[model samples]
Target chain A: MDKNLEKKVINYGEAIYEATYQEMQRDNNVFAYGLGADDPKGHYGTTKDLHLKFGKNRCFDTPLSEDGMTGVGIGAAMAGLRPIFIHQRMDFLLLCMNQIVNMASKMRYISSGEHCVPLVIRVAIGRSWGQGAQHSQALQSFFMHIPGLKVIAPTTPHDAKGGLIASIRDNNPVIYIEHRMLYKNAGYVPTNSFEIEIGKGRVLKDGNDITIVGVSHTVEDSLRASELLKSVGVNAEVIDPISLSPIDYEIIRNSVMKTKKLLVVDNGWTRCGFSSEIITDVAINCEKITCERLGFADCPCPTTPSLEKHFYPNPSSIAKLANRMCGGNIDWSPPEVVQHEILSFKGPF
Target chain B: MKNQFDIKKAYYLFLLIRKSEEKIIELYNSDKIKSPVHLSIGQEAIAVGVSLALSKSDIIFSNYRGHAHFIAREANLDKMWAELYGKSRGTARGKGGSMHLNDISKNFMPTSAIVTSAIPEAVGYAFALKYKKKNSVVICYHGEGATDEGVFWESLNFASLHDLPIIFICENNRYAIYSHQNTRSINDPIVSRAISFGIDAERISGNSTEEFFKATIRCKEKIKNNSKPQLLECMTSRWQDHVGVTQPELSKEEENNIKKAIKHDDLKNLENKLSKDEVLHIKKRVNKEIEHAIKFAEASDFPRSSELLENVYY
Candidate 1:
């Protein structure tokens, strides 16, 4: 194994920081601001040494007013500065909802092409260490719902640097979601500046049996699940759609055609989630596929270590689902889901 | 071109807003303007005074009562009327109605019904201008009610701290909807509140367009010379209701005092100052302008429903 691949096993937060730091160095317009970016005690140490290198003006701390600071970033973006705005947690991004959705996302449309807002907002998604409800929400799906936004969720360190580079160069606003769990997980990232094109999905493995599609940290989980299935004599293909919006459905559809079976692993809510979108797309495109399954439960992630084990899907869950779709549980009858109709109408007669 | 006043041009601007507001009220009631309108009939001086003092590069964030904004900025009266009529030629492509009328070419960003929402954004704009070392200013126009929003204070602190070029124009029109200014805050003089923050502030008669010019001139000079933010609280009054049709029932004494305070019928006063023939000629010219605007709006086409998604992702 190469020495570069050796560093790929580090934390995901470090990977995001490396990507941000590299992008800032590559582009003069790229800047980062949040709490602890300036202080030696960086929030996740992703911004460590940034203030020392770039000066406080370029990489500085904000006054805990997320709403005000976010608006400042939006304003700076409008003024021809491409700012990589960092929020410590994804949940805290809620504090600047108006700025993110109303101001940053809609400023270009509001200006009727008179102004272009190029902003990359980096947020840490986590269910980390009992921070519980306030700090555990993953909101990439919420940003994807907005029309003028591009969402990037990169699992590998290489893709992290590449996505950050692409986002900084894009004219429109991009929401870069960095999972806290993948910070130290390094990979073979290039030493120089380059862009990994956005809106393209990567096929990690090739097979003719079943397809497993996942995003962000869940991509790694899906790969592990595919390996477990392989040990049990099932060849499962895996794909990582780095860009959530403008998703490459053709790749998924092509893979599903060969496999005739699909499984989507999402780390977000089961209802109206990214997983739901993938499943619905596959159902429509590949109607005769042997089986389809979504691997997210309908509930908020739990805080306790043991309960969180049940909360998030593991390789075993993915493997079990893949096996079920392969008709491994032939003797067991599937539960019958009864359909119900309830209608209440109020009309002027 | 320098720091000088054009009194005649300034008077013309004031006349423009006053006449525009009068026309808006007539159209609003007559069903020509489908949307509810907020007329700044009595507060013409604030918009005219501030706009005249500003350069074309200087931006403005107007509130709901923005007819004065359109007229003061000398925006096309036809486009202004077309906007109110929901025609495709409107300032916001007819997507934004009365409250959201935005003309970016004139440097007036879209107005929001949410009070003080644009306050922090204005500060952000000023911050960018300052950071880029550009001689630009953002005139954030809000009402006394906006003071209640926490962003108002947040923006004030950020603007003053950074010494950004922002002119916080608080048009104190006595009432923010149903709530009176006194009911909201204990300070009778909000300008003094600005002084506490080390911001140069003044409390002036917002009704008098001339006073607004003087105040805004002083503010622009300060913003340019020192890059510090300033506050000008115009003690203005609205001639109509908060929104749509106004039924502001003033007593006989109140009406008499208000009439004397703002001198609503300035034509009558000008008639006393000039000849009756001159006043009639001015009225005749204004009527012609209004008629031209009406014809333009009538001829303009309404926006197609397909255009709803055209600019959402520009």
Candidate 2:
């Protein structure tokens, strides 16, 4: 359970695999399935030794049917198998809406807790790979909006491993999101297997200038911004709310109280994004935040590297905002806010 | 163990489907059971035959037109009617209407709506069986229209390549919605396509109970004992329109022709083997069972709204 004992700088993808493998070793009911896992190269080599070690029954390949496989996971979970389903790309999850939303999410409520479908669905969000609009979207919030689903996006190796282990052992269906870029990003993880409780958020770094909330790949940008802000004498505290659903609002609120200003760095699109919910919550519950700047990929993420850099929020953009907000010239009014009122019907005044 | 199947029980099951749907039709027009119904009136033999071949452990995935299939699987008629009436006590806690009926405890999964949807699920169930090295088989029931989905071909390929024990039952009710077999496909012979999958297949009269059972017996033998995956195309007819409550678009003469095929004598052909009293007793018993089911359903209360969110997760 100690995080310092394990090797540092391990790929988040490999860490997730190790975590899942350890869980599988602990329980015979734990199994994994998806495309490329059975292949020799194994899609980023996340599931390299799984098939050889666990045999084909535990580590199996599936035909290209996400809906069917998702349902199979649901049924298997009902039959006492802790199954983990993998969708190579996030967009492919659209095909399995009925399975995820209708069957998996609602099974517990529909069955009156007679049975729990404890299935884990892992998907990758690739932005810089030039996957274009269809393949590059970071749409984890879509599933997060679902009430019954427990959603998690672990940015570092430690959280990736710990979150996966927790999800496999949890008594509810979990949607595990991993970023394509963070797959190779390494961090220190515990040697012995352990579980990270789902729905609890972690504060990566503590400071007092401004609270920078980020998730998945954006966590790296937030940490980078924290470094840049520190160089400029503006201390920025970074919070990585790893689990998206059942989010630890307490940690977020506590961070906001110290900072007094909030910046949401998201990898998803801007409009109706996860950032919107954070901003709305801050507006309602906590002190009025200065420059609630939501840094997201500018447009539909382009496949070309040159265009994608502009799409995703870089350290420069986050640091610039952090410096500006800390400097006290903060304009919190969004563009949609009207500058002047045009009266079509003026009766009272 | 030689004749693991009981023919008398099979015949009784067939009579159950027939009597149940007939009563359902009577109740539908009389406004007692008020919901859109797809009565498997004439298609009882197919469900009965398919279910007879199935062990209690074997899984069956049925269609939206699945009253007979549910009854054939021995699902409680009271809960089924409760579901139709939108009572919380229904099979799906009143959430699933007629189309998305499922009783997992009984090993019957029916997606009462969504055409061609459950086929791939059945295939996946079969794949899971193979993955676990279980000697169980999955029986999938769909109309000829389901063949149009890409999942059908994909499932067929997966089943054949893996040698999974799955019986793909094409309950060819002659029509899908309003379109006849000719309108839906170029050829009416659905079984011919199954041969291309390099699997044993057949086409039998779905209306004939004895013939349907014989075909299913042969297919079940191939699926279970021989470890061979197969498909059985039952050329049956829907006694009612595409939906049961609505009047069929067929002309009076055309409707009568379909009804003629559903006469009591159509089943009485096998009655010579039994004495007059025995045949009469079977009919009387079936009619009594139908009356009891209706009474039970009528007495059942609607499902409480609290149960609506009970089965959404897990």
Query: lDDT (0-100) at residue B263 of candidate 1?
Result: 62
Interface RMSD of each: 2.1, 3.3
Candidate 1 DockQ vs. native: 0.37
lDDT of 1 by residue, A108-133 (tens): 65544556678888887765466466
DockQ comparisons of all candidates to the true complex:
0.37, 0.28
Q: Worst ten-residue run, lDDT, model 2 chain A? A: A338-347
- Model 2 residue A273 CA deviation (Å) reads 2.6
TM-score of chain B of 1: 0.91
The 10 consecutive residues of candidate 2 chain B with the worst lDDT sum are: B1-10
TM-score of chain A of each: 0.88, 0.90
- Each prediction's TM-score versus the true structure: 0.87, 0.87
